[model samples]
Target: VRATQNAKSKMAEVMPDVPKKLDDWKAAADTLDQGGQIVSLYHQLAIFTRPSEATTAEENAKVIWRGRGFELNNDTYMHRQALMACLPMTLSEKLHNDMRRMRRVSRKTVANAIHLAPVIGEWRGTATPTLILAGRRGQLMTLDLYDNDQGNFNGAIIGTPGSGKSVWMNEIAWSYRATNAQVRLLDLGRSFEKLCSKANGQFIEFGPHSPINVNPFTVVDDIDRDMAMLTPVIAKMASLSAPLEEVQYKAINAGILRVWRAHGKDMTITALRDLFKTGTLEDLEIHNDVRIKDLAIMLEPYTRNGQYARFFDGRANIDFSNDFMVIENEELKRAPDLHAVVNMILLYQITQDMYLSRERGDHRKKLLMIDELMQQLGEIGADDPVKARVVEEAARRARKYGGSLITATQAADDYYSSKQMETAFQFADWVFLLRQKKESLELLDRSGRIVMDDAKKRLLTSLRTEPGVYSEIYIYSPMGEGIARLILDPHTLLLFSNRHEDNQAIDQRRARGLSIDQAIDEVLRERSGKPS
Candidate 1:
């Protein structure tokens, strides 16, 4: 009984101060209600629970009851009865503490789920709905679709062959198709067959037999920056062997400019080659000299005379009148004109289209994915006039005209010599790095101006693994904010997000050219190993 009395004495001391605090709160609440300020009371209540002085039971009861009434009150009545009712002070205190605890628990649960799960689902508008997958060597792979805002996306997959790169690429393609995006793939490795099958008749295969009839030179939507850099080199080569007494190099440039102005709208490698085959020295009013021979040699690399023709001859059955061109050849030739002219034709076409689209106020987004861009650029030195101009335009103005260029290569060192590549790297909104060779990583680090702390270095180092399982992604935004991190597991399969059984059935049906119902039956029959 004596111990209980002492505890009661302590409560009395604490309880008196509570009422005083409540008195002040009551006055404040009353003023807020009369002045039409009660709408903000809930926010104040949330703030008040944090280490403030206690209030009287009567005063506290008013605040608590009013808070409760505020919640239950309809939109119509909430303004009128903002401070009339009183609540039990003890109950209100208990409720607030419980809510705080619940919120903390909920946050922790979501964090854990995100850490363990894969990003799945198609992007709606500009949002990237991704699934993070665990990759080898403590890396995380993420499949993201960045809407270029034209009509297409800048799509990429980072993983080694067995690490699920192919699976992820196919899944992304499938998701894009679901949104009604037309995908034109130049799959040199033939890794997209399963994905192509899923597109039904939309899928077109381009091999040696059913080739694309369009010339790479003619379909200029956007000039590749790398190609632009090669132009001056071609010009220089054209000047090298010209006899001193022949038509000046400036005249040749002027004539070439005239050709571009007159025929640039319909210019293509096929067209240019035709021009060279049928056009004579009289067309440019120049003498036939060793300089002409040099010009021919410089343009030899880009001409259709060699193994390069196989690329033009191997396109699928799709119409290239409006679509982007895809060349499958990887060989590097010595002729500067061949390289320069091919690139020029493409660049001119792209820029011309962009100009027309801009004039018409067309906002359709487009994407140009150039694989092994460095290989093409390396053939043209910095001195090439036409190549230089092409690269400059691609890096600078393509984005304004609703086009985005995505270039991928194995190493950053390959682009070191070309100013065009350097320019693209500087302006590229995003830079993605997968498991890179040490030399390649160093080059990228230096070129991108990346500064790493101990934690970041650790992350980058961890990304380098055997058979290259880990990928270090460096995302640079034109908005000025950048993110660099190590994904512990790379989500390589976008297909895992789909209903796997449904997708498999669709694939089987597509291969057999069956209707949806028939496809379902065929898949079941195949699974059961029975004839349908």
Candidate 2:
């Protein structure tokens, strides 16, 4: 009786609303007694009482069954399965104390028996839905992104270079494409070529010599939103500071809007730059205070005959009608400034396209997968309101448009090294931590998606990478968290492998004028000892 009062006092002290929760549970019980429908109290209790790590499996099993108020006699042996099965529900008087000892405790939705049964052994519930092999324990575990409730369909994968990050990205992209979802990738390392080809995807190479040029002014579907998107780039370019920077930003925004309006379909970066050079912008409220000449001088480099004149100056040479599009940025690796701008433009374009597609009543799934996302988003401050809004708006694209944005990086430092990186990762609903550097683990721990206790840390460090097979990965999401080895079949392995010879062979096949699908079939025949 004393212990019960003490427990109640502790609960009251820790949770001021304890009485409310208990009353709600009591009301639920009363309803059940009166043959009313079962109710959810939104309160949950999970008990983790493990035996000593050094103990044998048999010893651990024995200890779990008979310890702490459990009475299992010699004649009535408790099967391990039965004991484990009852673990979720058996109410022990001593367990309350253990629950109080834990921290960061919050109320979890208390699901009734029928609704909770399938969630016990697997992540899915009731009917077997479309299952994509996300990872495997003893057998393949599947997850359906379309389910919406299990997760938000957003994902972030971070790991060291050789830790199979690309492999997993390839698998997930291909899996979605196989399910008939429109998939796209912003390829950083010239990877995903073979896989892109296999899916009959358009592989676009953006380089100085490449015919592709993206003019953000004309390309942007919505001028107001695009003006906001261009603000960061303009701010970064002018190297503006304080009052002058603010004045220039407004002038340049008004100038672009005016040029885009006047030129309409003919508007390009070159024309926009020319307008800033000589055009008057009396329409803008701040036109009298700002110097249009300074803004034009800042924008000259992106205009005709300037250093970046070749990019975003001419007409857009590429088409977005294809279901699968892979934009390879291998050539722009050394040009960080141009790379960042182009990335923003592409992201905006994709977002616009997705919104337009949805507006046209096409609700098919779309994805924007970015490799080396940290390099693309640049160093955004955690508190910088403008950049913060940009990241938040990017996250909202998932709901507004029926598409998901996924990013993969080599280190958590790349995404958490700055405030901007911090905000970017925070918006993600799913995280996959592959084999990472010891230093990176600290950042991951701070991510708050997965607990970084000694046991979990040990589990993360124990992950191994093997050839021709998937590496071990720790996946965490709002639904749950676990360690599983990423699984892939032989055909997918061939398509997504990073082997040099295989890629060269695929290139050779493409050179022979074979369609990507035909090339894939031929390569499969060569691998199988069958006639092509």
Candidate 3:
């Protein structure tokens, strides 16, 4: 009010026509007094030239500024104070002293003062970051794959072959284990053999020769929930061509109820298959159902005297009692017909383990890492969607049960190409993208669904890997994002190596009465040309 009165007095005395200017001044002063949205803008202008061409550089700089409609100001008078004011991390005392002599805010502040600079996108991850990673600036940082505030724990890892994807996964699994979390890795490639050995974890090679009593028929306290989960596995076994109708699922459920009523704890695929011999689908109220009978016949291979009887007919013999268990099935690729079927069996069994209660009632933090997520997803058929739904539900609710899912694939086509895989892996809150094909990267750019800033896009496109030394990866995470290097020492690199030669060397030493650790040390000694 005092300023308004003084402005009126001045205007009436000698500047009657300048009242409009006074009004503008009054509005700005009022905004300042009211503490509105006034932000300080900082801009950095870099001028590079040879010492001898300094004069010419100044003239060129002035011309460039003028061309951009910016008036040039010679800072020779207080250059040090002006430059220091623009620099971050400077002391506030020095900043206040430097800025006190600077020009006041004007209409030109927003019009010309804000230009992009080398800003810091530093993210100090979660309070307890599980993994240690180095940022683009070589600053040590931490990474937490799961944060409860985000309410997500699922992760996705994608990369090209030999791009250190295995090493990256080894780091994550190792990091999680360091926190005492229970880890189950479904690795078909045997990539984590050495890491599993080093961790003293079970590296069970699952195959036709190795028998695992994975009974997907075991009852839980909640029979309805158990049926909801078990029905899909049976439906997939009987029908894999297309999606089964609701009636077919109901018939399968009804049949399970009858079998469980009679078999009790002896419920095996063989028993279930045998139930249809004397019993009709009508006994279970599923009349006129040739599909249910056909389903039983289709499961004959899993019954007694059937081809898969030895593997599927037994009770629970496999133990995931250990904290870290790696179930490697290298023979999966050799059997093309049972690829989808086998994947479904292994995944559902693991899901059961995740949901089951222990005798000690200790709920260890459970984590399932699927190394070939896309390939597993690829096994899913168009009409046969039970596999996809199974995976989706498992991942969607894993976080609620003190568990998480981690998936890795070679390309986007590994998951995106299959609708089944897409739905299953889409909830990934943390993603690692190593060097990939341009086409795959395009799909990764949210397929144009979510807009990516140009800076992030450039960083992603610039990703490159120097295998064995370091792998450059862009982390798209719910916590934060940055390009980091997964650099391991020689020991860790050997332990997580997926190299065939390394495996052969380890095997050769083991055949000569050496333990896995002894074999690794011997191999490393041989490579270093040191005597034992």
Q: Each prediction's Cα lDDT score?
A: 0.44, 0.68, 0.72
Provide the global lDDT of candidate 2 against the true structure: 0.68
Name the lDDT value of residue 304 in candidate 1: 60
lDDT of 1 at 291: 51
Q: Residue 206 in candidate 1 has what lDDT?
A: 37
- In candidate 2, position 35 carries an lDDT of 72
Judged by lDDT, which candidate is best?
Answer: 3
Ranking by TM-score: 3, 2, 1
Residue pairs of candidate 3 with colliding backbone atoms:
242-383, 242-384, 243-383, 374-414
Task: For residue 105, give model 2's deviation from the true position in Å.
Answer: 34
lDDT of 3 by residue, 314-392 (tens): 6756686788989876676665435566666667667667777443465866789988875554354653367667777
lDDT by residue (tens digit), candidate 1, 1-532: 3333544565647666555555545555566566623211122121134344434443564676576463322224433222221232433545545545544112222333454333453212223434343433334434344533333233322333343333434444455455443334434343454444445523333344644433433443334432442244335334322322234344444444444556653543333334344334565665554554444554453346644454343221334333333443322235443444444444444545555666676555444545445544545455443454566576455665655555555555645556666655555655555554556656556665555555655555455333223333434343222222323222222222134554666566667777544665565567669976
The global Cα lDDT (0 to 1) of model 1 is 0.44
TM-scores of the candidates are 0.49, 0.71, 0.79
- Ranking of all predicted structures according to lDDT, beginning with the best and ending with the worst: 3, 2, 1
Error of 3 at 470 (Å): 1.8
